[model samples]
Target: PGKDKGKDMILLTKMDKRPPNWTFVFAVDVARSGSVSADYSVAIGIAYNSISQEKQICYFWRSKGLKISEQAEEIAEISKNFNHPYLLVEQNNMGQDMIDELTDKYNVNVEAITTGAHTTGKNIKKEELIRFLISAFEHEKITIPRGDEYSREQMSILEDELTKFCAIPTPAGNELFQGVGAHDDCVIALALANRATQTVGIPFAVTLGPGRTQAGGVYSALLQATRGESDIEKMIKLGIIK
Candidate 1:
C-alpha cells in the first residue's frame, strides 16, 4: 500500500519557453567623386541596431574615386555578409542607372536618400540639420559603435574634415560651403540613417477596437525596457513616449 501511494504521488512538470528576438539591420553607403578618376568611387557602411535605440554602428570603406560598378559590387558582398534589408545610398556622380544595375544584380534594395549636396555658406538652414544630428549624439538618442582601427581612423579624419567645413548663407539666400573642396556627404548620409531610425523609433503591437485587434504603434517596447525610470519619465514628458 505504501509503495502504491508513492508511485501515485509522482508528477510531471513543463517549463515555459519563449523565442529570442531578432534585430533589424539597416546598411548605408556614401560615395564621392575623385579628382584623378573620371567617375566617383567611395563607400561606407553604416549599420543600425534596431533592438536598441541608443546604439548605431558605422563602418567606413574607401576606394579609388573611380569604378562605380566595382564599388557597387563590393557593397553587395558586404551586404550579403551583413544581411541588411535595404542599403541607403547617396546618388551623386554615379548616376541612377548604375544604382539600378547594382540592385538588380545583387538582389539588394537600394534607396537613394540624397544627391550631391555639400555644405555651403548661405546655407544657415543646413547647419540646423547638422545640429540636429549632433544633438542626437549628445543626448544619447543615437550612437556610433566602435569599429576596427582603420574604421576609427577614418571616422576621426571625417570628423576633422566636418569641423573645418561650415555652412554660411550667401546674398542669394542659399547655403554654401565655407570650405572649398571639402565634402561632408558621407558623414551626412550616415547621420541621416541614424536620425531617421531614431526619429521613427520602433514599431510595436497594440490593441484597438472592441475586439482584441492588434495595431501598430511608433514607440518600441524594447526602448522602454532599456530605459531607467528617470529616462522613461523624461521621454514621456518630451512626448517621445506615451
Candidate 2:
C-alpha cells in the first residue's frame, strides 16, 4: 500500500518477495501517449484467498508517455517481481500491440478481455465491467490500501475519480461510462484486476483456519487503486466507498 512515485511511474510494494498462500493476478488498461488528453497506462496486481474471501490490491503501476513496447516491458518486469501472476489485458486501443509484444518478446501469458465490437470470444461491456467493480465495493468483497502519505493520496485520487464517474446517455441510446473531466484509466485497470479475482481459476487448495497450504506469498502491502463511474452520486451518498 506504499509507493515510490516517480515522474512517470508509481510502484507500490512492501517487499521484494511474494507472500504466502495467496493467488495473484495482474490486470492492465493500455493507453497511448503523446497527447495531453491521452489516458495513463495502468497495471494492477490483486491478491486473494479463495477460502477466506480475502481480496486486496497488492501492486500498482501507472505511467504516461510510455510507448507500447515500454509499457509491455514494464508490465513484464513488474509481473515477474510479483511471481508472474496471471495477466489480463483489455483489448482496446494499443492493447493488441501490447499483447503481441508481451507474448512474443517477453514470453508472458496474457488473457485478453474484449471491450470492443469485433471479438470472437466473450466481450466485457463497459456496464458489465463497472457493475462487477460496483458489486465488489457494495458487498465489501474487495479493499484498497490505506495509510502512508502516498497511499493516502492515491486512495483520495481514486475516490475522487469514483465520485466523478458518471453514466452519460449517448445518441444511440446507449450508455457511456465517463469520468466527467477526470481520468478513468485507474478505475478501469482496477476493475480488471478485481474481475480477475472473481473469474480466474485457482490452481491450489484453499481452506479456512490454520494449517491451510500456502501457494505463493505476496509483499505485505494493502490494496490501493480506483473505481469506475456510474451512479457514483448514489454510491457516494451511501458511504463514498473509501
Candidate 3:
C-alpha cells in the first residue's frame, strides 16, 4: 500500500522473518514534496545481527509529492510492518517537521540525526555518512538483494549514484559530495541506514555482556543456538530470538 502517485513506490526483498538476535533499522532522508523535479524522499531498511556479520537491505521506498504529515504516516506504517524498527530520520529541512508528526501523531519513537556538530547523541556529518557507507561496502558488510525487478532497479540507481558521486573541495578545505548528473537521495538514505547499524540505541534488543540477568541470559543462549553450540537450539524453536 505504499504507492500513491504514479512515481511514488515501495519495494521489499520478500525474505522470511529474521531471527530474534537480528535487529532492524530504518533511515530516512526527507525532501521537498509536491514537485516532480524536487528531490525524492527515500527510506532504507537494513537488518543486522548486532554482533558480527553484514547488514542486509530488506526494503526500499521513494516518493515525492507527499506532504509532511503523509510522509510521517507512511513511515509509521512501515515501522509497524517491520516489527517496530529503530528509526532514524535526518533532522534537516522538512525532516524535523516529519519527526514531530511521527512522534506526536503516530506515537512512533524516533531518533534525529543532527546533520552538524553536536555534543550528544548521533551527530553525523555529511562526510561521515559517505565514509561510513564506503567503509561498509569496502568491508563487504552490506548486502543489496537483486532478486526482483524492483530490487534490481533500486540497486542500479545506487550503482549509478555511486559511480557519479563526486567530491568538490570547498573554499574552507572541506569536501562536498554530490552526484554529477544524478540525485543522491538513494545514496544518502543508504548512508544513513549504514550509520544506523552502528548505533547502539535499540530499546528492545539485548546487548551482549557478562551478566546474570534473565534477559541477558536468554539472549546469550539464543546466540549460542545460532552457532550450534549446544542443546540451546530450543531457544530458536521457542521463537524467543526476536
User: Global lDDT of each model?
Assistant: 0.44, 0.67, 0.67
What tens-digit string does per-residue lDDT give for candidate 2 at 1-242? 11322223223563234356568878999985535468888887877767665566667777888888888889988877776778899987788899999999998878888875432364766665765666556545556666456766676666677767776767986667777754888889888887777666442223332222222222101111122235555555544243
lDDT for each residue of candidate 1 in 24-48, tens digit (9 for 90 to 100): 2343443444345442243444333
- Once fitted onto the true fold, the runs of candidate 2 whose alpha carbons sit more than 4 angstroms away are 1-21, 33-37, 117-120, 169-174, 201-230
Ranking by TM-score: 2, 3, 1
Candidate 3 deviant stretches above 4 angstroms: 1-15, 117-121, 201-242
lDDT of 3 by residue, 83-149 (tens): 6778889888888898899989988868898767542566756765665565455444566666567
The C-alpha local distance difference test score for the whole of candidate 3 amounts to 0.67
Candidate 1, run of 10 with poorest lDDT: 7-16
Candidate 2 vs. true structure, TM-score: 0.74
Of 1 and 3, which scores higher on lDDT?
A: 3
How high is the lDDT of residue 87 in model 2?
88
Error of 3 at 224 (Å): 41
Between prediction 1 and prediction 2, the one with superior TM-score is 2
Error of 3 at 147 (Å): 1.5
